[model samples]
Target: MAEFTFSTEQQELRKAVRRFAADNFDEETVRRLMESDPRFDPKVWARLGAELGVLGLAVPESAGGVGGTLVDQAVAVEELGAALACGPLFGTVYLAIPALVAASAGAARDELLPELIEGRKTAAFAVADQAGAFDPAAVTLTATDGDVTVSGTVARVVDADAADVILVAANGSGGVGLYAVDAAAAQRTNLVTLDLTRPQADLEFASAPAQLIAGPDEAERVITHALQVGSVLLAVEQVGASQHLLDIAVEYAKTRLQFGRPIGSFQAVKHRLADLLVDVEHARSTAYHAVWALTDGSDDPALAASIAQATCSAAFSRVARDAIQTLGGIGFTWEHQAHLYFKRATTDAALLGSAEQHRDRVAKLVLDTAAVERVPEVAVGSPR
Candidate 1:
C-alpha cells in the first residue's frame, strides 16, 4: 500500500476540531460534565453535530451523512480525545453506525441511519457480556417470535442510558444476530466507573421488543466488523490523548523549577519526555496505518487493527503513567487533570479488548498465515 499521510483537508479538519474542543471543552466544563447526570452535555453534543458535521463523518451521503471515510472519523476522534471531551460520540459513531452499515439492507438500516447521521437519535452497542467479553457466544439474551429479551445484565455498556436506540447481540432461533431495542424498554442503571468522564451503564431487558438487523448467518460477521472498526478508531483516540499528555508533561518540565533551574534541564526528566515523544509518534503511525487500511480496504484490516490496538493501548498507558511522574506531587492530587487522563487511559485500554488480547490476536494471525505459507506443495498425482 501507499504511504499514509493526512490530506490537507484532513489536517485542516483536525485543527478545526482541536480549536473547537479548546474553546468548548475546558477543564471546568469537562469536570462538570463528568459529575452531571448523563455525563454528556446535550447542547455541546448538538453543536458538534450541527457545526462540525461530526456525527456523519463516516456515514454515506444517501444516509444523510457527510459521505466521509473512516480516516475522517479517526481525525475527529483524535481531537476529541486530546481535549478529553466526554460524550456519546464514541458509542454512536464507532460502534453503532458500523454495526448498522454491516447489517443487511432493511428498515433497521434505512430508518435508523438517517436519524443517526442527522444526530436526531443516539445508539449504543450491547455486545459486552457480564464479563465484558465481546464474544457472541457470551451473550445470554434470547430472542423469540421477533421479541428479544435480555434477562442477564449487560455490564459496562457505554452510553446506554443516553442512547435512544440500542443494538443488542442476542441468541435467536436463527442463531446469533443483531437486534435493535428502544432504550425505554430496557432498565438502565448508570455505574460509577474508573473514568467518570466516559460513563458506563448496566442494562437489563425483560422481553424488550426489538427489530432484527442481521440474522444468525450474518450477525457474527457484522459484529466483528463493527468491533474491528471500533478498535482501530479507538487507537486513534489513544494516540491523541497520549500526545496531549506528553505535551503537558514537557511544557510543565520547562516551567517547573527545582534547585534554581527548570526541571526540563535535568537529564532524567529530558530522557523520560523524549521517550514518551517517541512512543506517541509510534502510536500515531500505527493508528494511521490502521485507519488507512480500513479507509482504502487495501490491506489486512484485522491485522492492522489488532496491531494498532495493542501498540496504542500500551503506549498510552505508559505515557499517562510517566506524565504523572514528570509532573511531580501536583499530578497526584485530585485537582490535577493528569489523573483524569491517566484514568481514561487505563480504562480505555480494557474497554474494547485489552492490550494482551490484541497482541495474542496479532500473534495468532501472523503464525497462522505463516503456517499456511509453509505447507508443502504436492506434485501432480505423486503423493496419492
Candidate 2:
C-alpha cells in the first residue's frame, strides 16, 4: 500500500484555508460573531462552499461533491480549528453531511445534499446526547410513520438554531432510525455554552413532520460509521487547536520579560513548554494515523480512532489549560484571545466523548482483540 502522504493539492488546500482564515477569521470578527444573534456570517460560509469548496471536499463527486478523499476534508477542518472559525462547518459538514451521504439515496439526500454543498442551507446532526452516547439505545426521541412525525427532544445539538434541517436519530415502530426534520418546525433554544465559537442548541419537537433517511436495520450501521469517521476528524481538529495553543504560548514566553529577562529563559518555563511540545506532537501523530487507518480501510480502524481520540483529547485540554498558565494574567482575561481557544479546547474534549470514555473504549478494543487472538497479556506500557 502507498504511504499516507498529503498530495500537493491537499497541501495547497491547507495553505488556501489558512490564508482565508487569516483574513476573515480575525480576533475582532470572531469576537463579534460570537456575541451576535446568528453567530456566523452566511456570506463567508457561502464562499467557503462555493468558491473554496471546503464543504464538499470529501463528498463523492458522483454525489455532486468535490470527489476528494477524507484527507482533503481533514486538511480543511484542521485549519478551521486552528482559526477557531465561527461557522456551521462542524455540524453541517462533519456530522450532517456524512450521515446524509451514508444513508441510502432518497428525497432528503437528493434534495438537501446539493443545497448543503452550495452553502445555501445548514444542517445539524442529533445522533448523540450530551454524554456523547450514539448507540441505538441512547436515542430518546421517538418517530412515528404516516408522514413520519417525530416527538421528543434532542439536547446539545450543535448549531441547531442556525440549521435549516436536523438529521436526528429516533426510535420508531421500525426501531431506531435516522429522521430528517425541518428545523423551523422544531423549537430551538440556544444554550449557555462554554465555547461561544461553536454554539449549541436544544431542540424540542412535538410530532414534527420528518422524512426517514435511514431505517432501523441500517441506522445503527450508518450511525456507528459516522461516529468513527467523526471521531477521526475530531481528533485532527484537536491536534490543530493544540498546535495553535503551543505556537501562541511559545511566542508569548519569548516576548514577555520578568526580572529583566525573557521568561522563556527560565528553566521551569522551558520544561513546561518542552512537555507541551511532546504532547502536541504525539497528538498530531496519533490523529494522523487514525485518519490514515480510516481512509485505507485498516483492520483496526475502531482501535485506531479510539486511541487517537483518547490521546488528542487529553493533549488539547492540557495544552489549552497550560497555554493560559503560560500567558499568565492575559490568558484568563476576557479581552485576550487565549480565553477563546481555551474555552474551545475545554468544550471539544467533551463534545464527541470524554477522554476517559475513549480510554475505556481503547482498553476494551485492545483486550477483546487480544482475547480473540489468544495472545498473552504482556502488561501494556510495562517494562518486561
Candidate 3:
C-alpha cells in the first residue's frame, strides 16, 4: 500500500469539518447528551445534515448526494470521529447510503436518496442481530408475501426508531433479500442500548407493505458491501477516537507533574505514547488503502476491507486502553471522557466482526490464493 496524502480539496474539507466539530461538539454538550433519551442531539445532527452536507457525500450527485466516492465519506467520518460527534451520521451517511444506492432504483433512489442527502429523510441500515453478528444469511426475519403485506421482525436495528426509511435484510424461501421498509409502515419499538450516544430500536413488520429492492441472492452481497462500507468508515472513526486519545494522553503527560517532572517527560510514558502513534499511523495506512480500493471499484475490495477492519479494530483498542492508563487514577472515573472513547471503540469494533474475525478472513484469503497457486509434486523429482 502507498502512503496516502489527501487531495487539496479533501484537505480543505478536513479543515472545515474540524472547525465545525470543534465549535459544536464540546465536552459540556457531550455531557448533556448523557441525559437525553435519544442520546443524539437533533440540533447537531441537523447542522451536520444541512450545514455540512455530509449525508450526501457518498450518494450520487444526480440523486442529490455530494457525488463523492467512499473515500470522501471516509474523510467526513474521520472528522466526525475526531469530535466523537454523537449522531446517526455514521448510520445514515456511511452504512445506509451505499446499501440504498445498491438496492433501490427509479422513484426510490430519486426520491429517497435526495431526501437523505438533504437530511430530510433519516435512514438506518438493519443487518446485525442480537448476537452482534452482521451476516445477512443469519437473518431470521422472514418477509412473507401476503394479501396486503410482507411481515417480519428485525432485532438490534441501529437508529431504526429515528429513521424514516430502513434498509432491511430479510430471508425467505428464495434466500436473502433486501427490502426498503417505511418506518411508519412497521411497528417500531424503542430499545435501550449500552452506547447511549447512538440509539437503537426493534422493527416489527406486522404484515407491513415493503418494496423489494433487491433479489434474494443479491441481498447478502448488498449487506456485505454495506458492512464493508461501515467497516472502513468505522475505521475512520476509530482513527478519530485514537487521535483524540493520543491528544488526551499527551496533554496529561505534559501538564500533570509527578516527582517534580511532567509525566509526559518520563521515558515509560513517552515510549507508550510513541507506540500509540505507530498503531494509529499503521491503522491509517490500512484504512486509506481500504477506502481507495472501495472507491476505485476494484476487484479486491473485500480483501482491502478486511485489512482495514482488522488493523483499525486493534488500533482502536490499543489507543483507548492506553488513554485510560495514561490518565492514571483520573481516567478510571466516569467524569473523564476516556471512558467514552473506550466505549465507542468497543461498540464500533463489535459491530462488524471483531478484529480477530477480520484477521481470519484475511488469512483465509491468503491461504486460498496460495492453495490455488500450488503445483503438484513430481514423483521422485523425475519430472518437471
Error of 2 at 329 (Å): 1.6
Ten contiguous residues with the weakest lDDT in model 2:
375-384
lDDT of each: 0.82, 0.82, 0.74
Error of 1 at 149 (Å): 5.6
TM-scores vs. true structure, each candidate = 0.93, 0.93, 0.89
Screening candidate 2 with a backbone cut-off below 3 angstroms (N, C-alpha, C), the clashing residue pairs are: none
Question: Which ranges of candidate 2 are over 4 A from the true structure?
Answer: 1-3, 129-133, 369-384
Off by over 4 Å in 3: 1-3, 129-136, 146-148, 172-175, 369-384
The most accurate candidate by lDDT is 2
| lDDT digits (tens) for residues 1-384 of candidate 1 | 356778899999999999989988989999999898878887778777877898778776766678888888899999999989978866888888877876767976789877776667788988863212257768868886654554445777888868999888888877888888899998999888899887778898888888888888888777777777888888999999999999999999999999999999999999999999999999999998888777666556667888999999999999999999999999999999999999999988887788898888788778856443332211100111
Compose the digit string of candidate 3's lDDT tens values, residues 72-151.
Answer: 77888898888788777656876777666665465555666667777777788776642222566567567777322456
Sort by TM-score, best first: 2, 1, 3
Tens-digit lDDT string for candidate 2 (1-384):
556678899899999999999988989999999999789999999999999999987777878889887778889989988988889876888777777666778877788987888899998888874323366667888886553899898788888878899988888886888888999999998899999888899999899999988898778766666676677788898898899989999999999999999999999999999999999999988888877666655436567777888899999999999999999999999888888888888888887788898888778777755444432111010112
- Candidate 2 vs candidate 3: which has greater TM-score? 2
Model 3 global lDDT (CA atoms, 0 to 1):
0.74
Residue pairs with backbone overlap in model 3: 56-66, 253-264
